[model samples]
Target: MYQPRKRGYRKDNATLRWSLPDRVFFACGACHILAYAFLERWGTPGMQALWIRPAAGQTGNHVFVDGGDWVFDYHGYANRPQFLAHVWRGARRRWPGWDATLVPLPRDVLISEQKSRGYDGLWLREPGQFLHDAMPRANAYLDRFRAPAVRTAR
Candidate 1:
């Protein structure tokens, strides 16, 4: 049985190990590659633009996304009900009118059916596709969230 971590646990440990330039470059490059791949699959973004950071002590601290009604888990896909009930209880309260039937990703239908007995989500054939699709929007959101850096002429 998998137990979720307590609420308000720190999902990320921000240590200033990498230089700002390094972090920015790495993030941009990664997002570019992902965006390219995602565009190849879905053509245009069809999912809702939301990012969900996994809880501490859960999977590798990877950021999840609400790809429309489905929660794109790196390991699998979580249905809307499951996502609301377990992962992020506040979502429903936040988006009251956002309602969509939870459907498994086409490729993961079989696996999802099996896992549905125990878990509230399913696995996708390529979960990255979903994540990549959501990246460009997420990147933009992150950019706005991060403060602009000040530079002085040498």
Candidate 2:
């Protein structure tokens, strides 16, 4: 007959020490590089450059761009593609007169982690030369989804 040994409570230092499995879990959870890769490969081309600002007097993470023409309640999205698709659809409907040749975010808009309310999507530091060079391609991409223009006789 064998007696079972009782386990003792762990000390504070013991709790602080992570096992190999624990370390691996933490590394995987904190891996922003994987997130960036997904964004680059599958995200809408110019959508990554848009800057989000918190809606005024909002209680939770409600954000907007293009002077409230595009609003996203970040809680609703499960992934990047869903969010970008929603934004693209909303912009098309709300601001049909907008300059489709350019990315939707304004040149003078300021983007900071604080303003973004800690949402971890790509954002532009400045309206860089890349955007200028990329505009024609981005516009071409958008044009594919746009409704054909209607002409009326004067």
Candidate 3:
């Protein structure tokens, strides 16, 4: 069983303890960054980044790529229904007071948030160091599903 871990724990305290594979697939709590990487790697024009939140001004927001029929997250690609059910159930189990809802995430807003949070430049520049195994994990997950055809010509 994988549980999400708090971000920014100190190294001397042994806070960054998960194995590479576990950090990539289950924990790390950096879904917004990973979601953007996944979008860059496999997103079609029809797909967009979205945040799942309980409501306005709430914590525990989750980010993932949303294709019309499918979604890609730390768990990899899955049909929309299964993804929603999984998120809803998991969220409810984790936080009994909130209900999850999908919210649109404009690219600009995402970039701004990333920048404000001190991740914008660092993540891309030193992805392996900042987010070990993310790209490789994304590639492996993507291998399980055929890439969506480009919905529109560039």
Q: Considering every candidate listed, which one attains the maximal TM-score?
A: 3
Best by lDDT: 3
Tens-place lDDT digits, model 3, residues 87-117: 7777667768667567667544443434434
The TM-score, computed over Cα atoms with residue i paired to residue i, of candidate 1 is: 0.26
Per-residue C-alpha lDDT of model 1 across residues 1-154, encoded as one tens digit per residue? 1222334423132222111232232232122222232333332245422323233223311123345555433223467567657534343344443332333222222213343233233222222333233344434434433221223459
* lDDT: the better of candidates 2 and 3: 3
- Per-candidate Cα lDDT values, in order, are 0.32, 0.28, 0.57
Identify the superior model by lDDT, candidate 1 or candidate 3: 3
**Against the true structure, what is every candidate's RMSD?**
18.7, 17.6, 5.8
lDDT of 2 at 73: 21
Sort every candidate by TM-score, greatest first: 3, 1, 2
- Look at candidate 1 and give me any clashing residue pairs: 48-68
lDDT of 2 by residue, 20-126 (tens): 13222112111122122223333333333333322333111112222122212212123445555554555546555322221333222222323333344333221
Using all chains and alpha carbons, the TM-scores for the candidates as numbered come to 0.26, 0.21, 0.61
Error of 3 at 146 (Å): 4.3
